[model samples]
Target: MPRLLWPLLGLLLLAGCASNKERPELTEVDQYREASESLESRNYLTAIDQLKELEARFPYGDFAEQAALDLIYAQYRAVDYPATVVAAQRFMRNYPAHPRMDYALYMRGLANFNMEKGLFDNMVSSDKSSKDMGAAKDAFRDFERLVNRFPDSEYAPDARSRMVHIRNQLARQELHVARYYARRGAIIASINRAQYVVKHYQQTPAVPEALAIMAKGYQRLKQPELAEKSRDVLALNWPDSKFLDNDKQVDLAWWPDEDDGLLSLLTFDLL
Candidate 1:
């Protein structure tokens, strides 16, 4: 009688435990699906709210991770740089080993890239305050990390292309400032800027222009030997460069002397 009573008691406890266990809620799933649909339709604000709510309610759950990633994307698409950075940082912290970690890092970089100053805007220092290019540099560094860590990622190619574009823009801005100084009769300032462009961005299209400016600036300072050397390099690399026409008459002063040889050949023809 005692053994039979103990077995009945155990069965009753098991039944109670089973009855107390709650079933998984479908509300979060429903909300996530609706928010995803809204995001697909370009209703980013609504999607962001829904994703945020889902994450707050389901924190530490699988859907929470998904919500965080979606929130980052929605913020990115809406051009909310600050929010995007926050979301990306949070996603990295929560899902450190996630397969999409590369994407989050890349997007973080892009958020800062969008905030970078324009090339022409940077040149107008008197009108506009000087801009900090640190953000652009950071963006490039992040993209480089993505490339190095995930070389086979689909985003690597575009990241590389954007880096080149940003570098070229920076180089072009420096060249523009150098020309501005040269035009203002600030020979030393112009030479300094031009030399910086040559040293830092030798591969850019602005290199030829920078070289021409450096030559012209040196010539103005009465450094004819250095001016001639720069001209020789410019002629060898970009004979038809448009920058050669920047200072129309001034460039002729540095042009190599071919008149003597031409006259000698013509004299021989006359003979």
Candidate 2:
């Protein structure tokens, strides 16, 4: 508490700070070992910084390629999807023939796949089919490429499964658009959208719904022949489809009615 002693204490604190800040320069191997330790401890942000520094300082060092791969995984584990995708892409571009090429592709696809997810996605059903499909489509293509290019890769099986899920999502998206148009009295547009799902999505679960929409749409347009054809096809292909009421009429009660104005918007139709 003395005035002279206070100055000395301040000088000692500053010297300690300076000593902490002045770390010895680390060798490439040492830097990589530090990053690996961070990664092992699940300190992804710290690992990301360390890995990036390692890559910058020794781009072609023995650990450079592994560092790049770890960067992708670190960014992903940090929930930084966009950065994960970028790092994965850079790894693929830089090391096309690397033994872990499939890993890079898988991470890229996985990043894009989860890019549309919200913070509460695990708690609430956000209806992924209602979200923008750009990232989903990108993820689909990435997974497809992984499957085609590395069928034997350990990641290929999961990639194939995700591809199937993405395909169904795409089909559901077309059905969603069709339902929107139908609710707005856009019969032709709804029919066109539904037909596109049937034609392009084939065996997807949405096919039955699409056929039902098309049937109802044609009936609304006074095209009885087309309506009958759609109904017949639905009966023949999906005998147990809920869209077929006792295999006679189209049952679309599951589809929402026309917009209910402010009430629908406020309640999101849950009411």
Q: Name the candidate that leads on lDDT.
A: 2
Instruction: Give lDDT: candidate 2, residue 70.
Output: 94
Pick the TM-score winner: 2
Looking at model 2, which ten-residue stretch has the lowest summed lDDT? 256-265
What lDDT score is found at residue 81 in candidate 2?
A: 99
lDDT of 2: 0.89
lDDT per residue as tens, model 1, 177-197: 775555555668878988998
Query: How many collisions per candidate?
Result: 0, 0
* Tens-place lDDT digits, model 2, residues 1-271: 5989999999999999998896789999999999999999999999999999999999999999999999999999999999999999999899988999999999999999999999999998777886689999999999999999999999999999998889899999998888776765567888999999999889889999999999988887789999999999999998888887774789898554445423444565455
Candidate 2 — which pairs collide?
A: none
Clashing pairs in 1: none
At residue 151, candidate 1 shows an lDDT of 90
Per-residue error (Å), model 2, residue 5: 11
